[model samples]
Target: MTEILDTAVDFRATMGRLATGVSVITTRSGSTPVGMTASAVSALSLAPLQLLVCIGNHLYTRTAIAEHGRFAVNVLGEDGEALARNFAASKADKFAGVETVDDHGVPVLKDAIAAVVCDVAEALPGGDHTIFVGAVRHCTHRVDCRPLLHFAGGFGALRTPRHA
Candidate 1:
């Protein structure tokens, strides 16, 4: 048991070194919007226009996503680090002052660099999280914005490669 616990700690530290784009996964619980900052989102399939997001088993947002059967991925812009931190915190209302627009019954963050509305295609049980596969239903973006990124337990803006 001690060995397993140590491995979990080491694994988390190792994964933190991998930089990822920041996003807020939003869904409606009844008429109220629920959201959480997630970096575990990824594209799963192209033919069917599907994506996947992993939500912690203990989060209320995960329950809302499972029950609602729909969600929106609000990919943060370079100016969105504060918003990401806001959603990342456990709170009763992360959207309290955040402006949003409706996208297929899901709340889309108005200032996101990009957003995608999706219908929950499949929900799979992972070790400590639920893997939600979503079939995209809508998409929108702002071309002028640069994506927010996460690395080593902190948020940052993307720096384009000089060679490119």
Candidate 2:
């Protein structure tokens, strides 16, 4: 077996170098809407169109998602750094001044590069985080927008590829 090291800082630093797309995960808590900025999302399967998002167990959005049974993944565009920062904060009014629309009882960002509505299929314990496997129920996307990326602890935009 490989030796284990108690180096969370090192692990985070190394993982930060792996570029990831930013997204706002949203769900409803009673009559209130809740959301948070997240990068721990992935497509789990194509046969059944499933996705997974890892959220801190203590987070309000996590609790909301568990209660609501539904959530939306708002994939941020290149210009969504501000939105990402806003949602990343621990403020109560994260949605203030932000435009949104309701879809399947969940709030969806109006200008996301893509929005995916999902029904919770499974909730698995993942250390301090809970991995929610969701089945895609609906989706919308804008092909013209570039996705916002996170790398090295900072937000960035993807460089346009050149074709010969």
Return the top candidate by lDDT. 2
The candidate maximizing TM-score is 2
TM-scores of the candidates are 0.93, 0.94
Residues 1-164 of candidate 2: C-alpha lDDT, one tens digit per residue: 26654599878987898999999999999989899999999999998999999999999999999999999999999999999999999998898999999998899999798999999999999999999999999989998688999999999998885669
Q: For residues 9-128, write the lDDT of model 1, one tens digit per residue.
A: 788877898999999999999999999999999999899999999999999999999999999999999899999999999888899989999989999999898999999999999999
After superposition, which runs of candidate 1 have C-alpha atoms over 4 Å from their true positions? 1-6, 161-164
Pull out the clashing pairs in model 2.
none
Candidate 2 deviates by what RMSD? 2.7
